[model samples]
Target chain A: MEDPKSLSNEESLRIITQMIQTAKGNLKGSSFYFLLWGWVGTLGNLGHFLLIQFSDIEYPSAIWLITVPAWIISLLYGYRQSAKEKVRTYSDTLIAWLWMGFSVCAVILIFSGRFNELIPATILMIAGLATFMTGLILKYKPLVYGGSSFWIFSAMALHVEPVYGLLISAVAIVVGYLIPGYILRSTI
Target chain B: MIPDFKDLDPLLHSQLRLAIMSLLISVQSAEFVFIKEKTGATAGNLSVQIDKLMNAEYIEVTKSFKGKKPVTTCKITKKGIKAFEDYVNTLQGYIKK
Candidate 1:
């Protein structure tokens, strides 16, 4: 870049637009986290369904213990990715906190045992809001659509059997995380 | 009427510096290497320009060690934000003219 005073308006405007584009381009190749969660959630939900259907387990819902590994993996993965990041955008921080807040809410709901029946609707609503906000921040349309799908599923989960709600949640994960995650990865 | 280019902040008017500010504005902070890569500016030149911005109180530059290697990070200061916004508005005025 030359002296700002010497450059014409056209050149300055071009540089600004170009630099913004460069920043956005750098955000690619970061979908691995999404895919990780997507797969883990899918497995957790399906596992719960199977556990309940096949066996008379004393506590079939205990199958959710699968998420412990997901949490550990997410922590490690987040640290690794942070190490690689050259710039941490405001949107990145916002997205991270959004998910973290979601996690906190989930823990509170599950542990309190007060709204166990409403867990599916509550979780799906939170997921929808987080995904939608993330999509808006990143300007990613697929994720926005995915979030909408989650909202729709959340509504449906209320009417269906609680067991089936797990399946619906899994489907939501596939749409919200897997498909868009892969797309984001492929584009990078 | 001629465009009121005088409203532009001289500090933010340069090609490289403006680009750097533009990048920094969108993020919390960025590594020196990342700025270099994005601007395609030689490190020596970027460092010099960064120092100028720092001296002007337009940006904050922090030096720290990431493991064994020294890392430099740059963040836009509040002054820098004001200057950049003013600069953009000035540029818009020029465009409108």
Candidate 2:
């Protein structure tokens, strides 16, 4: 076998170009997943709005109903993608399980009438911690930093009035989801 | 007074090696294929460069099976990371006038 490291600069450059081409090809093949995620988010948001505004439902109650099916769908999507991506790491599986746990907690807290005041705050805190842990486990900087920010904001929001809680959630969605999603799309 | 390049040259200071070092600095571990794709190096070339780094004690390599296929993962050692930073600092000295 030829000494792989003994290539001239030009030969190395040629191989590097081929590697990049292969990566781009893989990205192109997976582009549909991006589109699917976008559609899922759009539908989730629409469902949220309908449940809150038109159905005469309480906000937390609305979230409970709306997020359950959304959570299921998203989990299914995640599982399928993880399998396809050959995510064999234990850390990846742990993150997936954590996400599912957060979703279940969110639904349960939303519907618990006796714990109405505490559940939202608890859910926010749990979600933030889960996101942060996911980011750390995956070693993805954006998620790590973004998730920590969410955790901080949610912790702070827990002390404030309900109205301010909504704003915190908005910021979490914007920074943690929207901004990062756009960045991912642009970079990859 | 600055020490000359002859006094302390980076052991794996080529462009591809530098690129590999930079990428490895950020992640816990990366697969050989990932590094090859990221650095745009051929498998053979990447394998060779990786071996050099491993020999220099800058990186640790693990060969494992991913289902039926063989996968090699590489991670920069603490010593390797410190060397990379030192190299960067030394390179900066030249341009800092």
List, residue by residue over A28-79, the lDDT tens digit for candidate 2.
2122332343344344444544555568755634443544565576668766
Classified by CAPRI criteria, candidate 2 counts as: incorrect
Per-model lDDT? 0.85, 0.60
* Local accuracy of candidate 1 as per-residue lDDT tens digits, A25-101: 34454487778878887888788778888989888878778788878988998897887788988888888899899
- The B-chain TM-score of model 2 reads 0.89
Tens digit per residue, CA lDDT, model 2, B1-97: 4446432244544667766666676555678877876777788877877888899899999988766888788888999988877765655564463
Expressed as tens digits, the lDDT of each residue in B9-89 for candidate 1 is 777878889999999988889999999998988988898899999999999999988778898999999999988888888
Specify the poorest-scoring 10-residue window by lDDT in model 2 chain B.
B1-10
Find the candidate with the highest lDDT and give its number: 1
* Candidate 1 wrongly placed segments (more than 4 Å): A1-5, B1-7
Candidate 2: C-alpha RMSD to true structure equals: 8.1
